[model samples]
Each structure stands twice: as C-alpha cells, then as structure tokens.
Target chain A: MLIMKNINKIFQTADIQTHALRDFCLQVNEGDFVSVTGPSGSGKTTFLNIAGLLETFSNGEFLLDGEDVGKLNDNGRSRMRNEKIGFIFQGFNLIPDLNLYDNVDVPLRYRGFNAKERKFRIEQNLERVGLASRMKHLPSQLSGGQQQRVAIARALATDPRFLLADEPTGNLDSEMAQSVMSLLEDINQQGTTIIMVTHDAQLAQRAKRTIQVKDGKVSELENISRQHNQAIA
Target chain B: MLETGLILRALARNKIGALLIALQIALTMTIMVNAIFMIQDRQQQMQRKSGLDEKNSFYLTNTVFGQDYNIQAHLQTDLHTIRNTPGVVDAIQINAIPLSSSGWSMALQHEPGEDKDAVGTAIYMVDDHAINSMGLTLVAGANFQPEDVELRKEGQSTWPAKTIITQAFAENLYPDNWQSAVGKTVYISQTQPIQIIGIVAALQAPWNGWNGVERSMLVPFQRESKGSYYFIRTEAGRRDELMPIIEKTLAESDKKRIIRRVTTIEDTRERSYRQHNATNKILTTVVITLTLITGFGIVGLAIFSINRRTKQIGTRRALGATKGQIMRYFMMENFIISTFGIIIGCFGAVALNMWLVNTFNLSPISFQLVAFGVITLFIVGQLAVLYPARKAAMIAPATATRTI
Candidate 1:
C-alpha cells in the first residue's frame, strides 16, 4: 500500500519559486488500479514523481508499505524502489543502444538477482508481453506499440508490488493505447497496485478510481468501478 | 561484474570514441616509458663518483710562455712551496683531472704482441703523493714509494715499470680475481711491461661518457714539460679559502709561466655532465606534457559520453540504480576502455623499447618499470573520469519523464 498526506513540493530557482505539489493526499491499496488525470503543468507528473521517489518533496508525509518514506536515506529509498516499486515512462525510456534483453536486465541487475533468476524473469515477462521472439532486437527496431510492451515487460521483470507509469500509452495510437491499457489491466489483476498518470478520459474510466490534479492540488472524480462493486455487495 | 559485459556491448556499438582514446593512451605509454628510461640512464651516468677529494681539491694549469727558465727546478720549487704552506694536505703534478673530458688512454694486454685483445684504461701521471692528494683508497696493494717516482720528459714513448690501477681496471685485466692483479704484469703500449703495484677501490676516467669510465691507472711520473697542472688537496674547510691563495702564490713564484684555469673538481664534474642534465630535463618535460594531455583527453571523452547519455543514466537511476552505482557505471566503462588501452600500450611500449634498444644500444627496459607504467596510466584514466562520473550520478531521475 502507498499513502501520502499533505505532500508539498516547491522547486526553487535563483529568481522564481514554483509550487509543483501542495497538500497532495493520496492512498493506493493493494490490487487497486488508479489513474491520475490533469492538464499540462497541473502537478500530475509531479505526483507520480513523488510517489515513485524519483524526486523529494519540500515537506510531506509519505508512507510506502507502512514504512515512512521521509525517514529513509538515499540508499534506503533506492533499495525500496528496487525491491518494491517499478516505473514506466511515456517515451518508453528504453536505452537505445541496448537490445530488448539487456534493457530488461537493467533493473534485475540492480535488484541483485542471480543470472539464472534474472534470465527466467526476463524471458517470462517478455513472453507475457508477447515479445519473447524479439528479445534480441533494439528498441528502434520495434514499432510504437511494441516498444511500450517492452517497457511494460521491463517494469514487471522485478515482480514489483507497486508500479508507477507516467503516460504509458501517450505516444501510441488509439488501438495501441487500448492494447497497452488491456495489458496494464491484466497486470493489476495479478495483485499488483498501479498508479498511472494520463489525460485520456476513456483510459481514466477503466481504473477502479480516478483523481484530477489542478494547480498543484488533487480532487477525487467519480469512481465507477468502486461504485459498481459496492452496489453488487 | 555484470556491468562489464553490458558496458562492453554498449561500447562495441559506439567504438569510435573509445578507440581513439585507447590509441592516445597507447602512444602516450610508448613515449612515456622510453623517455623515463633514457632519463634514468643519463642520471646513472651522472651519479658516478670520480674518486677525488672533489670538495677539498682544485687544479690549475701552468703554461710557460717565456724562455731561459729552468722548468724542472721551478716545478719542484712550486710543489715544495704549495705543499709546505698552511692547511695543505699534499700536492702533485697530475697529467689530467678525472671527469675533465680531456685525457690520455692506453691499451694493455697480457703479452707483448699487438695481435692480442687489450683492455683500455685512462692514464694518470702522478708521484708518491698521488694516493693522498687524490684521496683514493688503496683497496689491495700499497701506494707508490718515493724511490719509484721517475722524471718523464716531453714526447717520451716509454712508461714507468710500476703502476697503480683501479679495481675496475684490475678486474678487466684479471677477471678471475682482482686481488691477484696486485703483482700481475700487464704490457702497455703493446710491449712495455707495466706491473700493477696497487689497486684502488674506484677512480673514474676523465671521459664520463666512456663505457669503461671507472677504469684508471696511476703511474709514478714527474713530468718535465712546457705546460703542466698542479693538483693540490687542502685540509678540511680550507679548499675554498686556499684556491685563490695557491693560484696567487704559483703566479708570483714563476714569472716565466702563467697560472690559468684554476678549477675545482666539482665544477669540472658539473660541466662534464651538463649535456646529460639538459637532456634529462627535456625528457622530463616531455613525459609531464604527454601525461597531462592524455589525462585531459580522458576527461573530455568522459564528459562528452555522459552528456550524450543523460537520459539513459536518469532512467537507470529511476529503475533503482543508486548514486554510487551510477558513478560506478561510468567508472567501469572507463576501466574497460583503459584495459584495452593498457593492453595495446604494453605491446606498444615493448615495441618502442625494442626499437630504442636496437637504435641507441641501450639495455632492454625493465619489467618492473613497465608494470609501473600500467599502474600509473590506470590511475590517470580513473582520476580523469571521476568528475564526469559524479556529474552523471547527480543527474535527476525525473529527467526520464521529460519530453524535451
């Protein structure tokens, strides 16, 4: 589970102070699919960054799996990120020079997995994403949708309990975006909590809950999947 | 360990930059090792002891430019006055000063035939006071007696029968046992049988660049010539004060001869090796400049590589690579590149050394020095890349999410 309370992120420059996130309270439980939606410069990416521990906030209370994140040192944060969290960026963020196999091996190497274990996970994840045959190909050799699948395979290779994806399908067409959304749904069904940031309304509805960010603050939107489950119970 | 193979694969794809730097390192090692070797060779040559009381001894030339003067009687008078003066230890009339770059050399053989191979040695013409005046240690035999001294006229072809040889020349003549050379008779001038009556521990020849610089021989000779050198050894702490006094006394005692070239052995040694010292300085400058250029080359290449891979580094950081791991990545990359350079450099250094050995007739380079080169270049390469690696480590992981 991931929880945030009154998280504040202020970017200070020589001449300007930009508040990226303010009072950003959030809670993501196990096996929950949450999508964050906002316009450009609305703190959507900042929330994802703070949640992923890619950047520190100015003042905040962040708890990941019941451990206080603010108290963790840099190495502690990196260990938590390696053992429990994974990330997928909109641009695929695949190392251009590395082939699919080596690209997927990056995090597993950092995770301290043995050669045999890393190979098994790399093969299994590539197979799950339906790109097992193209494991030796570089990212440029693949189409737009294929690269995102490879990215998703890399994210899942470490068996992370929580996955943070920033616009996972933003660079894809409608058909490719829908396919990646279906892949994410399948991952969430396997007991992985996911928080994805996007601007697509259709993709937002597919999640169990949705939040909208405006001017460095967050507000809950309608929760169709939660409401449907409550009605059935 | 796992990063090695991955970094190698990545470098294989971008081989140009790394290959260029490797070649630079190879060339640097080649010139650097050989230059140091040359400098060491010259330094060894310059450090040889000339077997003189160099600090307490000085010599001056007495040129007879007038007629109707008894040169032999005045020579004795001058020696008597200089030796009886205050603070004077002993004095002699020497044919040449060691390490002065001008002297006489004669070849000696066991038999009286020119067909046999002869060992060459520098010849010093001095009398019984020679051992004390030059501060030479009699390692094996005795010094020349006063009765053994002889008067040698100008253009004399014959040599004195008794002579004292340095241990090095004794070894050359009697390679089996140098102490046996004390009573051995060696034929000089191909036929003149000269007995080695004594053996000094060491006495360098006048010509420092000669291969057999440590081989010298002293003969008992009081020369009767138009020009000669008066070599004097003063008491401790008195040479500097006595240098001018002795020159003045010798000048005033003889109106027919002019006292000139009043020089200390120390000054002669410095003047003798000035060229070696200059060459060593030049080679040192070259080594320093080459090393610095190679270091800057490494820094430039690492910085360019880090700038190109900023986003990749950020993505790796986001994927759970710690800052230390990020720094190690670049450092390991440089290590791999440096390993390649060092391999080529080893071969390049040896090849260059072989050429130098063949061309310059120097000894083959030492393995320890080559190993030293390897360690030094490796350290240089790593230190050169440190700042750029740290800069790459400082890259924020949020950069992976940026569109621009």
Candidate 2:
C-alpha cells in the first residue's frame, strides 16, 4: 500500500520559487491499478517522483508498505526503492550499452542477489514480457514496443510489490501503447500494485481507478469501469 | 555482486576512450620504470669511493712559465713550504689527480713481447710520500721508502722499479692471491721490470666513466716537468682554508710560474660527473612530467565518459544503485584499464631494457622496479577518476524521467 497526505514540493532557485506540488493527497490499496491523468505543469510528474521515492517531498506524511518514507535517509530510500518499488520510464530507459538480459539484471544486482538467483529472475521476467528469445539483443536493436517490454521486464526483475510508470507508452505508436497497457493490466491482475501517470484519456480509462490532478492536487477519483459494470448488472 | 562484468562489457562496446587512456598509462610505466632505473644506476656510480681523502684534499695546476726554472729545486722548495704549513698534513708533486678525467695510462704485460696480451691501468707519478699524501692504506706491504724515490724529466720514457697498486688492480693482476703480488716483478712499458711493493685498499682511475676505473697504481717518480699538479692533503675541515694560502704561496714564491686552476678534490669530482648529474636531473623531470600528464589524461577521459553517460547513471540511480556503488563502478573500471595497461607496459619495459642492454651496455632492470611502476600507475588511475565518479554519483534519479 502507498499513502500520501497533504504532500508538498517546492523548487527554489536564486530568483524564483516554483510550487510544483501543493497539498497533494493520494492513497492506493494493495493490488490496485491507479492511473493519474493531468495536463502539463499540473504537478503529475512531481507527484509520481515523490510517490516513487525518487525525490523527497517538501513536507508531508508519506507511508509506503507501513514505513515512514519521509523519515528515511537517502541510502534507506535507495534500499526501499530497490526492494519495494519498480520503475518503467517513457524512454524505455534500458542502458544502451547493455543487452536486454543485462539491462534486466541491473536492479537485481543492486538488490544483492546472487548470480544464480539473478539469472533465474531475469529469465523469468524477460519470458513474462515475451522478450526471452531476444534477451541477448540490445535495446537499440528492438522495436519501440519490444523495448518497452524489455523495460517492463527490467522493472519486474526484482519482484517489487509496487510499480511506478511515467508515460510508459509516450514514445510508442497507438498499437504498441495498447499492447503495453495490456501488459500492465496483466501485471496488476497478478497482484502487483501499479501507479501510471499519463495524459491519454483512453489509456487512463483502462485502469481500475482513475484520478485527475489539477493545480497540484488530485481533483477527482472515478472508478469508471466498475460503475459501468455495475450499471450493466 | 559487483558490476564489474557489466562495466567490462560496456567498455568493450565503447573502447576508444578507455583504450587511449590505457595506452597512455602503458607508455608512462615503460618510461618511468626505465628512467628510475637509470637514475639509480647513476647514483650508484656517483657513490663509488675514489680511495683518496677526497674531503680534505686539494690540487692545483702549478704551470711554470719561467725560463730555466729549476723544476727539481722548486719542487723541493714548494713541498717544504707546503709541508711546513700549519694545517697541511702532507704534499706531493704528481703527474695527475684521480677522477680529473685527464691522466696517463699504460699496459702491463705478463710477458714482455709484442704478441703478449696485457692489462691496462692508470698511472700516477709521485714520490715516496705518495701513500701518506694521498691517504692510501698499505694493506699488504710497506710504503715507498725515501731511497726508492726517483726523478723523471719531461718526455723521458724510463720507468720506476717499485710501485704500489690498488686492491682492484691487484685482483686483476694476481687473481690467485693479491697478497702474493707484493715483491713480485711485473713488466711495464714493454720490458722494464717493476715490483709491486704494496697494495692499497682502493684507488680509482682518473676517468670515473671508464670500465676499469678502479684499476690504478702509484709509480714513485716525481715529475720534474714544466707543468704538474701539486697534490696536497690537509687536516679535516682545513682543505678550503689552506687552498687559497697554498695557491698564493706558490704564485708569489718566484713570479716565474703562474699557478692557476686551484681546485678541491670534491669540486673536481663534481666537474668530473657533471654530465651524469645533469642527465639524472633531466630523467627525473621526465618521469614526473610524464606521470602527471598521464594522470591528467585519465581525468580528462573519465570526465568525458561520465558526461556522456549522465542519463545512464541517472537511470542506474533510479533503479536503486547507491552512490557508493556508482563510485565503485568507475573506480573498478579504472582498475581494469590500468591492469591491462600495466600488462602491456611490463613487456614494453622489458623490451626497452633489452634494447638498452644491447645498445648502451646497461644492466637489465629489476623486477621490483617494474612492479613499482604497475602499482604507481594504478594509484594514479584510481585517484584521477575519483572526482568524476563522485560527480556522476550526485546526479538526481529524477533525471531519468526527464525527456532529455
């Protein structure tokens, strides 16, 4: 589970102070797929960064899996990130110099997994993403969809309980975007909680829960698919 | 588990920068090791003893430009005046001084014939007081007696019968037993017999660079010539005080002779090996400069590599790599590259040393020196990469999400 209450983030420079996030509040239960949708400059990325423990919030109560994230030091936060949360970037941030298997092995290496354990996890995740056959190939050698799948496999290699994806299909065609969306649904159904930040309304509708962020705060939480199913019943 | 294999694979794909730095380290190691070896070699040569009281001795060129100069009478007068000086320990009229780079040499044959092979040695002409005046220790036999002193005019080829040879020369001439050389006859100047009356511990030749620098002997014949060196020894700490006094005394004695070139043995030794000293200084500078350039080259390459990999480093951070892990990755990368370079440099050093041995007749280098090179370059490489690695580690993980 992940929770944030009145989280705020400010960016300060020599002559300007930009309030990126103000009084943000969000909570997601176990196995939930939450999609956050917002316009540019609505603080969606800042919210996701703080939620993923990639950056610290200015002041707030934030708890991830029952641990106070605001109280953790940088090293402890890194350890929590390695152990509890997985990330998939829009750029398919696979290290270009490493092959697909090696890219997947990166997080697992930081997790202090033995070579045999890491190899098993890497193969399993790459197979889950349908990239096992091309595990030896580089990210540049694959198509956009396949590269996104490899990124998904890398995020899954450490068996983290939570996943944060920032516009995972932003650089892909609509077809590849749908395919990656389906993969995320599958991962969520398998009991891994996921929070996806995107601008596409159609893709946002596919999640079990959707929230709209505006003026650095979540303005709406709508369970659109559950309501439509209930009306059909 | 470390990221060593990952880093190596990455470097294999992008090998140019790392390869160039490695080659620079290799070249530095090769030159540095050999330069240190040559410096140590010269230092050892400079450390050799010249078998004289070098610290308390002085010599001057007593060139007589006067007509009908009673060379023998003046030699006695000059010796009496120098000997009676308050601080003078002893004085002698000699043909040459040790390590001055200018002197006489002759070959002594076991058999007196044109077909016979002979051993070469430097010749120093002095009187019976030669041993005491030059501070030579008679290890095997007695010093020269006064009756054995002889006078030899300039351009005369006649030789003295009694001589004192150094232990090094004694070892060469009588390898069986050097002590047996005393009182034994040997042939010098192609047939004249001269007996080795005593054996001194050590006496270097006039030329310090000569291979036979330790092979020399004192012949008992004060040179009655137009020009000769007045070899004087003073009590400890008085050589400098007495040098000016002696030069003034000899110059003002008759005005018939111009006594010039007053110099101490220490100064002569310095002038004799000035080239060796200068070469050592230059070599030391080259070593230091090359090491610094190689260090800076490593830093430059590492900074470039980190700048190029900024996004990748941020991604790694987002994937949960601690700052320490990132630093270790770069330092380990430098270690691998330095190890590769040291391997190539070992062969390069050996090849260069072989060339020197064959071409310049230098001895082969030591293994310890090559190991020292390997370790020095490794430290330089690691230290050079530290700052850039720290910079890479400080990159925010949020950079991975930014479009750039």
Candidate 3:
C-alpha cells in the first residue's frame, strides 16, 4: 500500500551537514507486514517518518495509496497522515490528561466523525485490543501491557490504511513484548499493513518481510515465510 | 464540536496558569473601567452650562494712559465710538463683570420686617446700559434707567439709584420664594438701605460656577466707578469687523491707552474648557499605555501557558481542534476572567464614587454606564489573548510527542 523510490534525507546543523538517508528505497503491498531492523542512527526512523508523511525527504518520490505525496503542502500532508496512517510508539505516547476512551477517540475526532460514530469505533477498537472493560481508566492506572493495548486501540480507532510502529515493544517486559507482538500479528491477519522498526531479531522474524537497514541504506530485504523452515531447523 | 471534557481536563492540568490568565484579564478590566470614567467626566465638563449668553458678547480692558486718572470721560467716549462702529450691537461699562475671578464687594443683609439687618453679599456696579449690553433678563421688576445712575458735575444733584437683586441672594432670607424677595429691602451697609427694584437670574462665566458663594447684587457705578471694564455686544457674526474700529477709536484719542485683552465670549469659554481637555488628553495617553501593557502581559502569559501545556495542546490539536477552536478556548477563559473582574470593578467604582462624592463633593457615578464599560473591557481582553491562542494552535505534533 506504500512505495518509495530513491528517497534522500539530510539534516543540517550550524557547522555540519548530515545525510540521514541516502538513496533509500522500499516497497510494501496491501496487507503486507514489514519490519525494518537496524542499529542506532541507521536512518530507520527517518524512513518510517517519510513513509508516514510526518517528515519530508530532500529528494525522492513517495506514492501513498497511489497518490504522489511530494506535491502536497504541510496541511495536505497532515490530512493524509490523519486519514491513512496510524502510529504506535514504544513509550505509548498517550495523553496523560485523558482516559483510554478519549485517548482512542482523539484521532477519530480529527477525521470529522460524529460523536456517536466515534464512540462506536472507539468501543470496537478497545474491545478488539482486549481493553473494552477498562476504556474509562486512565493510562497511568493501567499496567504496561494494558497501556500498550490502549495505545494500539487508539491507533486502530481511526481505521487507518497502514500502521507505523517504531519499537512498539521497546519499553515493555519480555512477556508484555511477546503479547504486543502477537497482537500485531493478529492485526496484520485482518489486512492492515504494518511497518515496524525493531531491534529484536526474534520479534523481527515474525513479520512477513524483514528489511535490514545499515549506514542510511537498506542492506537486505528477506522473505520471512521462505526462511521459516530454516528457523524451525 | 470539540469534546468539552478534553478542554476541562487540559485546563485543570495547570490551575495556577489558568488563574494567572484570569488575574491579568481582571487587572485590564479595572484599568479600562477607570479610564472610561475619566472620559465621561471630561465629556460632562464640556457640556456644563455657563449662566450667560456669551456667544455674541466681547469684553475689553482699557490700559491706556495711567491707572490713577478718572476714566469716566474716556469710557464715555469709547462707549459712544464703539456704538457708532459698524456691526456694533450695544456697549456698556460696568465696575465688575459676573464670574470674574477678582472683584470688590460689600457685605449685605436681609431683614424679616421692620429691621434693616442683612448678611454679606457680593455687590456689582453697572451702568443703565449694562442691562441691555449684557442681555440680562429680569425675572421681576424694571431695568435700571440711565438717568438713575448718570453722574453730575460739581454742584450738581446726585442720581437716584435702583438696586437689582440676584436670584441666589433672593433665595436666601426669603427661602423658596425668589420672586417675593424682589420688593424686599436690603442694605449694603447698616445705614444705606437700598430698595430692591428688580431681581435678576444668577450669571456665571465658565469657571466661576464652582465658587461656593452665588449671591450677587447690581448697583449704579457713578463717580466711584474706578478700574471698571467695558462689555460690548457685537452683531451675530461681526465681532472681527467691530474690533478694528474700537482699536482705531482708542488709538486716536489716547494712543498710549491701548485696548488690551480684547476677546470674544467664545475665546473665554474655550480658555475655560482647555484645562479639562488637557486633563482628558493626559488620561487618554495613560489609558493607551495601560492597554498596551495589558496586551503585552496577556500575550506573554498566554505563550507561557501554551508552552507549559504543550502536550495538552498537541493532544487537542491531534484530536481535530481547528485553530478557531483553540482561539475560542483561550477567549472563553479571558471572558470569564473579565466578567469576574467587571463585577468586582463595578463595586470598586461605586465605592470610589461614594468616596469622591463625600470628600470632594463630585457628581454621582452611573452604574449602568460602568457596566457597559466593563463589558467592553472584556472584549479588549479577548483581543489580547487571540494572538497567543493562534500560536498555541500551530504547535507541531512532533514537538508535542517528544519528551520535554
């Protein structure tokens, strides 16, 4: 559902220019689950931002749902991001002032949904993430896994076309991380494309496709199902 | 529509900041209320009535020759010459003008019946022609005749003089009946009991209305008319034309005796009002300065508030709040603050007005108009907050998501 061709990103400081992404290229079809694995400062987050229309690339062509993103202004980009992309951060990034129901209702409000419609969508998403009973609870009141579930529910509440998760389980314990990974798999099974950036190789192996990024460029693009037998061996 | 719950939660997160905003708005309302009061005071001063029809009248002081010489002949000649001048309506000489800052007076008293007792009252000396020249309307009795006060030479008979009583003087001793006091007897001294022939209304120049004493009496200025001034009434739009003629008439006779300070009634009125205008201008400057300070204060506070609540604002923005929504949020806060301030300010204004009325005997304050002024102050507070709210609305989601 998302495509990039020869994307280049550069960051400038007062006395130095840094190339964050050089000739970066990627492609993901509809309902594809992709995980981008890389070490620190490997331009993985920059690539994800470009794909999500959160940041612009210096030189590149990006096609989101077959619409050229380079021609859009900031407002247009924001609208597209709101409508088509959902973000999941490792830290959960929930508004502390709001409870889970309102937290999930936030993005849905931006989509111009009516109150009744937003309520229905939020309830369904919360139930799907197994937090329907705790929808009124605050993020601080929930456990780490429960908070992550609420974050996932918020992301899914807008019914976005794709999900961009940066280290989705980085802050969670092993048990919570595995539960969150399984939750991602179940979400992918329902045909929502997810591009995750994770350093855990075991978690990366669960995705349908794995792309390894190094030194601001993609080094490998491997098909996970084709290597499943080798992993089982 | 934005979720009201979110706005409340956002504001509740920073109670102190919200209170700060309210406090600033309240202060602005207070300053604006007083500023409006000062403006109203200025407008009232402008509309105050001057007791005489001074528009067509002009006054001139003769400084010709020397101060000690008798000016009766010179004054008569000047009066006749002024009457002959084109556009000259009427001219007369009087020992003292109404509402003049400095004048000579003798104590007078009123008696109940057979007694000749009276209290001290201001006495003015005027020629018979002064009644017509000054356009003084008599409330009762007849005008003084010229033959009554006309001066006689050596070995000539004394003129029979009539007295004019002012309304204020008539009010005293007579109580509520001003007309009945006309026929009553009053004496300038215990011996000289002048029969009151007529009663005239009190007259004031612009500034003299504030003086506590209002009683004035008119008598004849005969041989004793020393250091007197001339009052001339010109045709409805002709004072400028008549001025040159009077100047020439004075210059031809005693060239040293120039007519100093020849001014129309409007000039005097403007001079009287100038003090109030200057005060109003200073007040206006102060109001403007205060408004700017208030505006800057609100801007600074709003920016700080939005910054401190950056995440909350971002959450609101991410929740689909338009820039207009954020603007209304802050404006509502300011509105509440202004409303509270205005309520307090109204009470303050009342207390202040009471103090002023008691201490300085100032006029009473109008609570209705003050309420309107306070409402206007609320509008000003909103304007002050609009800029900061817009900046808050434009905060980036990326910045909000990042750790503080």
Candidate 4:
C-alpha cells in the first residue's frame, strides 16, 4: 500500500550540508509486515517520515495508496495522512488532556464521523486492544504497555490503509515489548499492513522481512528463514 | 465550536495573563467614561444661557472731555452722537454691563415702607434706552424716559429720580408680584432714595458661569458719575463698519480713553465656552490615546499568545478544522476575554461618573454614554483578535508531527 523510489532528503545550512536520506527506497504491500533496523544516524526514520507524508522528500516519487504524495500541498498531505495512515510513535504520543477513548476517537473525528459512530468505533477498537475497561483512563494512569496498547487502539480506530510505527516498543520493558509485538503481529494476521522501525534485532527477526539501513542508504534486505538457512549452510 | 473550546481551554491555563489584560481593559474603560462625561459637562456649560442678548451688541468706553464737563452735558452729547450712527439701533451708558464679571454693588436697608433690610443689588446708572436696548423684558412699571432726565430738559432733579429693579431683587423682598415690588422705595445707601419705575427680569452676566444673581438696576446718569461704558447694538454683521464712525463721532479725547476690549458678541460667547471646555478637550485626547494603546497592546499580546499555542492549533487543524474555524477560535476567545472586562468596566465607569458628579460637581448623567462604552469595547475586541486569528488559521498541520 506504500511505495518510495530514489527518495532523497538533504538539510542545508549556510556553510554545512547534511544528507539525511539518499537513494532510499521502501515498499509495503497489503497484509505484509516489514521492519526497518538501523543505528541512531541511519536514514530509517527519514524513510519512514517520507513514506508517512510527515516530511517532504527532496527528490523522490512517493505513491501512497496509489496517489502521488509529492504533488500534494501541506493541506492535501495532511488530509491524505489523516485518511490513509496511522502513526504509532516511540513516545506513545497520545494527547495528555484526552481520555483513552477520546484519544482513539480523535482521528475518527477528523474523518468526519458523527458522535454515535465515533463512540462505537472507539469502544470496539479499545476492546480489540484489550483496553475496553480502561476507556476513560488517562495515559498517565496506564502502564507503559497499556499506553502502547492505547496508542495502537488509536492508530486502528481510524481504519487506516497502512500503519507506520516508529520504534513502537522503544520505551517498554521486555514483557511489555513482547506483548506489543504480539499484538502488532495479530493485527498483521488480520490483513493490515504494518511498517515498523526498530533497532532491536530480535524484534526485527520476527517480521516477515527486515531491512537494515546504514549511512543514509539501505545496507541489506533479508528474509528471516532464508538468511538462517544460508547461515547454517 | 470544538476549536473555540480548545482556545478557551488554553487561555484558561494562563489565568494571570488573562487577568492582566482584563484589568487593562477595565482601567481604560473607566478613563474613557470619565472623559465622555467631562465633554458632556463642557457642552452643557457652553450652551447655558447668559442672561443677555449678547448678539448685535458691542461695548465702547467713551469718555467725556474736560475735568468739569458736567455729567449731564457729557451724557447728552454722547447719546445724540451715538444714536445717529449709521448702524446704531439702541445704546445705553451704564456704570456696569450686565453679565460682565466687573460690576458695582450697594448695600441697602429697607426704608419705612419697604419689606427687607440689607439687600445688595448691582447698581447701574443707565439712560431710558438701556432697558429695551439690552432686550430686558419688563414684568412691571414703565421704563425711565429721556424726559425724566430733567437736567438736560428743564430743571429736573439730578440726585436720583427713579430706578429699575431686577426680578431677583423683586423675588427676594416681595416673594410674588413684581407690581407690588415696584412703586416701593429703595436707597442705594443712607443718602439716596430712588423710586422704582420698572421691574425687569433677571439678566445673566456674560462672563459669569451660572445664573441667579441680581444683574443690574438702571438709573439716569448723574453729574458726579464717572468712568462709565456705553453699550451699542449695531445691526448684526455690521459691528466692524460701525467702529470707525463711532470713533469719529465721539470726542477726540474720548477716543483715546476707549480702554475696553471690543469684538462680536458671538466671540464673547465662544470665549466663555472655550474656557469651560479646556479640561474636557484635554481629557478626551488622553482617553482616546490610552484606549488606542491598550487596543494595540491587546493585539500584540494576542499574537504572542497564539504563537505560543501553535502546536495546539496545528493539532486542531489536523483534526479537519477549516481555516475559518481556527480564526473563529482565536476571535471568540478574545471576545470572551474582552466581554468579561467590559462588563466589569461598566460597573467601574458607573462608580467613576458618580464619584465625579458627587466630588467634583461635574455634569449629570447622559443616556447615550452607555452606547459609547459598548462600542468602544467591541472595537477593541475585534482589532485585537483579527491578526492573531489569521495567524492561528494559517498554522499548518505539519507542525504537529514536527519537533515542537
């Protein structure tokens, strides 16, 4: 559901130029799960940003749900992002002032859903994430894992075409991370495309495919079992 | 609606800042209300009637020649020359002009037949024509005639023959009926007893701020009288033309003795009005300046406030709010803040106007003042909100995903 070809992002100051992304590429198909792994300064975050329409690429062609994202203005990009993409941030960036239910309902409201429909969708999403009983609780009132679940619930409530998760379990403990990863896998099993960026090799090994980025370029694209068999041979 | 609610919630977070703005609005409004009241007070002072028909009248200080000219001959010559001037309608030679700040007064005790003792009235030695020339209405006896000035005719008494009493004097002693007040006796001092020939309405002196004084009583000029002025009515718009002729007709010696100021009666009225309005004009300017500064201050602060909340605005924008919605959010937020201030300010204004009325003896309340207050507050609100709302509306949703 997402595609990027020869995407480049460069930051220029008066006397300094930094290449954030160069010759970067990414693709995610329907019902497929993909993980991108990199160190701190790699172009993985930049690729995810361009793919999700959060940042513009300097020289690139991005097709999101088959529409040319590079041609969209700020407002048009925002509209497409709201309608077609769900973001799960490493910080679990739920609005602190809102309760869990309203946090999940926010994107739905932007989609012009009425009050009754928004309530129903928010409750169903919260139930799907096993947080139905905590709908009225604040983010600060929940544990790290519960908050990530709320974030996931928020992402799925809008029924976006694809999910873009940037370090979804970066702040969680091992147990919480595994639960979030299992929940993400179940969502993928239910036929939703998820593109997650992480630095954890163990978590990257669980995805259908793992892409390693280094120095603003993709260093390796490996499948899970084939790489293991090749290592055994 | 949701956007506006969001703005209000943000404003509520900075309660102290909002309160400061409210206080500024209230204080400025108080100053505005007082300034308006002071202007109205000045207007009332300007329009208040001075008891004479100051229009068409001019004063000339004409002096008789010779140390021993004899008041009777001097008066006859001056009156005859002045009456024949081209634009001359009527003239009076008097010791004091009505409504002028300068005047002469005498304390009188009631004689055997009079009702009161020790009543003071302004004394003016006027000829027969001074009454009608000054446009004074007679409520009783006939005005003194030229024939009564027997010193110029035959052998008339020159000491004191008759006098006109002002209505205030009549009201003081008689309490009713100027007729009974007339035909009574009054003495300028212990020596002179003048019969009352006419009772005229009270005259307002032009320079006085208010009415209700015994203006002037008329009498024929006596030989002992000296240092008197003449009031002449030259047709409206013709005073300038009459000045040179009047100068030519008076004795050359008298011309040099014309020490008084002369101008149109309209100018005199405006002079009186100008004095009363000086404070009001100054107050108005100050109030207007302060209100404008406060309004711009509000605009500047609102811009700063919206800039600080850009992330919140971007989030709202990302939630499908239109530009118009964001604009209305800021505008409505400011309107609520201004409204609260205006309501409090109205009370403050009332208290201030009342204090001015009670302490300073300023002008009374006028009904139109409320409309001015409301309009000023609304204007402040709109001007303060316009640029801020526009800026808020222009904030892009991309800002939400970017590092705050």
User: Which number leads on TM-score?
Assistant: 2
Residue-level lDDT of model 2, residues A1-233, one tens digit each, is 89899999999999999888889888899998999999999999999899888899999899999999999988898899899989999998889999999999999999999999999999999999998999999889999999999999999988889999999989999999999999999999999999999999888888889999998989988866644745777
Pick by TM-score: 3 or 4, better one: 3
Q: Write the per-residue lDDT of candidate 2 for residues B1-404, one digit (tens) a residue.
A: 58999999998998998898889888999999999999999999999999999999999988888887799999899999999999999999888889999999998877777777888999999888888888888899988888888899778898988889999999898899989989888899888888898999999999998989999988889888988899999999999899999989888887988888989899999999999999999999999999999999988988998998888888898889988988999999999999988899899999999998899989999999998998899899899999988988898888888888
Model 1 stretches with alpha carbons more than 4 Å out: A226-233
CAPRI-style class, candidate 4: incorrect
Note the Cα lDDT for every prediction shown.
0.91, 0.91, 0.73, 0.74
lDDT of 1 by residue, B1-404 (tens): 34887898899989999999999988888888889888988988888778888999999998998888787898889999999989999999989889999999988899999799899999999999999998999999899999999999889999999999999988888889999998889899999999989999999999998989999999999999888899999998899999999999988887788999999888999999999999999999999999999999999999999999888998998899999999999899999988899889989999999998899888999998889889999999999999999999999988888876
Q: Model 1 in CAPRI terms: which quality?
A: medium
Name the TM-score of candidate 3: 0.74
Query: Cα miss at B249, model 3 (Å)?
Result: 5.5
TM-score of chain B of 2: 0.97
Clashing pairs in 2: none
- Ordered by TM-score, highest first, the candidates read 2, 1, 3, 4
lDDT of 4 by residue, B1-404 (tens): 34344345446657777777877888887778778877776686566554455777777665543465566666667777788777788877766665555676655555632444666667666677876666678888888877764332333333466788777777776776656877887666555677888888766543455433554566665333545677788767777788666766674535434434554456666665666667777887898888888788788878887887777566555444556767876778778788878888888888888898899876655657866876887787788789878988888654554544
Pairs that collide, model 4: B51-B204, B99-B205, B99-B206
In candidate 2 chain B, what residue range of length 10 has the lowest lDDT sum?
Answer: B108-117
What overall lDDT, based on C-alpha atoms, would model 3 receive against the true structure? 0.73
In order, the candidates keep a fraction of the true contacts of 0.67, 0.69, 0.21, 0.14
How should the candidates be ordered by DockQ, best one leading?
2, 1, 3, 4
Q: lDDT by residue for model 4 over A139-233, one digit each (tens)?
A: 88999999999989988887887888888998999999999999999998898888899988888877888899898888898866424645777
